[model samples]
Target: MFMKTFGWSFAISAVALIVAFIYGGLEALILCAILGVLEVSLSFDNAVVNARILERMSAFWQKMFLTVGILIAVVGMRVAFPLLIVGVTANLNPVEAIRLAMEKGSIDDPGSYAYLLHEAHPQIAAFGGIFLLMLFLDFMFEERELRWLGLLERPLAFVGRLNGASLVIGLLVLVASATMVRPGKEIDVLISGILGLVTYFLVRGLGDLFDVDNDGDTDADDAGALAKSATRGVGKAVGKAAFMLFLYLEVIDASFSFDGVIGAFAITSDPIIIALGLGLIGAIFVRSLTVYLVREGTLDDYEYLDHGAHWAIGALALILLLTISVEINEIITGLIGVLFIGSAFISSIVRNKRVTAASLPSVDQLSS
Candidate 1:
């Protein structure tokens, strides 16, 4: 099953590596491999989150995610989006942006592709940060049957009983983040953050609006509720609700990728290598992992996996906000996410063992 699921990712990765070798010899190939690994490491938690949502989508939409969705990831976000940002910020035409990126212009120069991208990082970070922050906040605020950090999550969930708690907290965090930005960039961060918040509400609102099942029952009030409520109407899930879920997933993926996209320049400014590494190889593997988890029922078997992923997301959101004023090592960011998910996996195993042990008859009971 694993092979069947990931065979294409491996094949694509191999081809990309070969292309990288041909394009820039051994150095490009190595950088591509490193960036690919980096993307996968940073996005492991993202895969868990995607699996939670993907399980509710129809088989056709699932295929669309792997096909059409990946096309957007590769061509749109990985390639054109970076160019667009560089172009808009640097006041270059599309052709100029493409040429600049291909030339691998001096990152130190203000007019360079890498330089412009770095300049735009504040806005990108703000947008991605708030989007992710809202996601994390919504997850924490929702009522759930299982809790990974009950002590903390329970209290938050209790407060979630209040109306629009996530929105309120998100705004506060956004304001706090905006205040900490460089004095001149405050408005930029504030506007970007508000756009992020609005984007989340729009997509989520669309999902909820179309969440009505065949019998006219609407259950997708929020992100947490969408999972269970969406699955309740699997056959009818292919319409707007499913499309909106797909859009939400794409937005989530894009937010998860902002840091990585900017960070890739630190390794190599060649957009081709970045695309080959992050998009073709990394993104594909992440999607395959999502499918593997869903088909294997891994999330259900490991109950806390979802919780851990959300916690990692929360940590990531905070880290992005922090990065506005403080520089953080990419390695540290990747490790933090791994730490959360790894601990959660261990906890789930221990819980399973305890449950099994309790269900079995004791020696005394057996004798009786």
Candidate 2:
């Protein structure tokens, strides 16, 4: 099962390693591998969250996730997205942006592509931070049957009963994060943050809108009409749902990639290496892991994995916002996620053991 899922990722990683060596000999290859590891470490929780959503999707859409989705992750997020940022932030044309990126100038130089990307970090952080925060906030606020940290989660769920609690909290957090930024960048953060909020609502709402089962609390006539339409258009409806989910998944990927893409510049300013390392190696493995989790019922086996992933996301959201004002090492970000996931995994093992022990018959009963 592991090989079936991750074989392609390994193959792609090998090819990317070769390309990296060709690009800049041993130095580039080493840097590329480091960046790949960095991306995977930082986005492990992302794979967990993705698996939760992907499990609901059909097998065809899951393949689309690996195929079409990889193109978007690799090309869109790792390559073109940074170029777009450099272009817009520095007022450079796309060609000029490409040339600037190709030059591989010192990141400290104001004229460098890396410098322009750094200048645009505030807006990028604002958008990505808010988007991820909304994801975390939604998860924290949701009333779930299983609560990993019942003490804290119960209270949050109680608060979640308030209308628009997540949105309100997200707005408050955005405003606070904006205040932490430079005075001039406050408006930029606000606008980007608001747009992030809107984008989440738009995508999530569209998914719900297309979902025939999600049309909550309908009258008999309305239900009958929906049932008839569903019977007639089930395939089309499912396709639409999958497409929307694909879009949602892509957007989530983009949000998660913002930090890794920008931080990859620290390793090397060459965009191609970043693409090869992050897009091909890192993103492929993450997607493969997600599919593996879904297919293997890993989430079901490790009950608290989802909770840990969401908590890690919350931590990442905070880290992204912090990066807007102060620089944070990528290592710190990665370690926090690993800590949450590892702890949850251990807790799950203990819980499973306890359940197994309790279910077994006592010696006296067995003798009888």
Model 2: per-residue Cα lDDT over 1-368, one tens digit each = 99998998899899999999998999989988998999999988999999877765556677798889999999899999999999998899999999999999767888899888988999999999999999988888898898888998899999999999999999999999999998799999999999999999999999888783342333343344345335324222236776787889889988988889888887789998899999899998999989898778788899999999999999998999999999999989999999999988888989999999999999999999
Compared with the true structure, what per-residue lDDT tens digits does model 1 show for residues 23-82? 999999999999999999999899999998887776677889999999988899999999
User: What TM-score against the true fold does each predicted structure earn?
Assistant: 0.93, 0.92
Per-prediction tally of clashes: 0, 0
In angstroms, how far off is 179's CA in candidate 2?
1.0
Q: Runs in model 1 with CA error above 4 Å? A: 212-236
Candidate 2 clashing pairs, residues 3+ apart or interchain:
none
Off by over 4 Å in 2: 212-237
Model 2, residue 254: displacement in angstroms? 1.3
Best model per lDDT:
1
lDDT of 2 at 263: 88
